[model samples]
Target: MALTIMIADDHPAVLYGLRRLLENAPRSRFVIADAVEGGQALLRSLRGRDCDLALVDWYMPPERGPSGRELLARLRTTFPQTTLVVMTASQQPAVLAASLAAGATGLYDKRECSSQLPRILYQAAQGRLCVSPSLEIVLERHYLTRYHWGQENHQALTPREREVMRLIAAGYTGRETAAQLKRSEKTISRQRRSALDKLGLNPDSVPTLAPG
Candidate 1:
């Protein structure tokens, strides 16, 4: 049976291109069930009809509705049976990591869509996790940096400090990290300072410690 797909992107050209791409992918059994231009339209379409997969753009205009991990998360919760493949032009490893953490089954870089999207869709239809090569490299560096930080400072910091550092390295603001860890922002800031000092990292240079 052919896999049915729903596409959601804020750009009309992207919607048209994706629809055409999936419809014409050689040897692939895919059907374009619906193509919509924003999150609201996508949700409306999905409520009225089910599809085997959904391809969503990671960033869309704020007026269109939620974007990024929030959009992926909503789709995952509301339509658990539909496989989600997120498309992004962002090079930030944190964005890619957050998408997977939010339940995306596949990550496709917009730059490689014409060459790699078909295989990504096929793998996602099979329920396999797929990460584009470029995106994978970014994530790999993120992990390696965290590993190095651990190796160098594991004994120097307490567990809470380590946890705070990890979240900070993953792009969370101090306040967001505090909310996630259920601590006060002041406490999070203090822990972050301690962790950075122990790691011999300047707070101003934290962004350089992780891949963006």
Candidate 2:
């Protein structure tokens, strides 16, 4: 059966590019069911509908649309059977980890593309957790940490702390987060420590996404 795919991104260029990539490839294997520009529309149009896969942008800016984390979780619930593949421009470890925790079956960095994208999308439709190639090592390390150390208390951290923690979990050192956030290493460390402290986990250990 040809895969039924939906593309959702806030940018016209991105949505167009993804549509073109999937439908115009030399041996296109997917059937473009519909292309939506915003998260809200994507969710609304897809609810109660059966689609094999959905490629969603990590960030969608419309006011009525759910963005980032909420968007991923919502999609998982709203369209339980639809495999979700989050698209992003960054290979940040935390983003990759969090997406999987939130039920994303695939994570694709927009900077990375081509035939591999379709392969992962297909894997996702088959119930596998897929991530960008460059991110696999980072994912292997933090994939456990995201579930064990951070998820339960994720709601406790400040926005800044969450940002710092995601990078740290992604295998980025404090220096990396500092440079990425344009802040001092001390500030990044403090934010990461604060988030970890709030979550009651030690940075030295890796845990599952849901502790039972």
Candidate 3:
């Protein structure tokens, strides 16, 4: 069955290009149910109609409505059944991580949308966490550079510590991470502190790395 998709962006050109790409692709598994400009329009369309998935730009005009993580979070809350894929031109690890934390099923770099978007969307449709290769590299480099952990130190992280660290690194708040892991906030804080100790990193210097 062809997956029904709703797309939203601030630019008409982007919406047109995306629609044309999906509509014209040979043996495409997707159908454009609706293509709208801006987050408010997207929300309005979703409220009136149901689709299998939503593809939205990360940055839209503020006047149009919430963008970035806030927009993704709202979509996730309001329409849990529809899969979400966020398209971004940002190369920041924090932004990428926050998108995932905000419930994006897939992350696609706008630069590679022409060639990679279909594959990314297909993976998300299949209930997989899909991230663009370029974006993955950016996130990896950010973690490696920021942590700078020795092999021994890296191996010292307990499974829970690793989980907490991963969520924290991904811009989740301590409360959110704790709730996600089904643990007490105190336990999450302890685990975070322990992980920081093992990595020999100063919590204050790392910003989000510090336990709340």
Query: What is the per-residue lDDT of model 2 for residues 1-212, given as tens digits with 9 covering 90 to 100?
Result: 78999988878887787788888876678988888888898988897777989898888885858867898788887788888888887666667656766777788877765667887887888887676786665555543443452255678889998887677657676666677889887777677667767765546543212211
Model 2: weakest 10-residue lDDT segment is: 203-212
lDDT of 2: 0.74
Model number with the top TM-score:
1
Better of 2 and 3 by TM-score: 3
By lDDT, is 2 or 3 better? Answer: 3
Pairs clashing in candidate 2? 93-170, 147-208, 147-209, 148-208
User: Is candidate 1 or 2 superior in lDDT?
Assistant: 1
lDDT of 3 by residue, 1-212 (tens): 89999999999998999998988787898889899888888888899677889998998998998888789888999999999999999987667777777778889999874778888999998898888889877755545443332123657899999999889878888778878999988898889888877866556535473345
Mind giving the per-residue lDDT tens digits that candidate 1 earns over 78-118? 99999999999997755776777777888999987476998
At residue 74, candidate 2 shows an lDDT of 85
What TM-score does prediction 2 earn? 0.67
lDDT of each: 0.79, 0.74, 0.82
lDDT of 3 at 42: 89
The parts of candidate 3 lying over 4 Å away from their true place are: 144-212
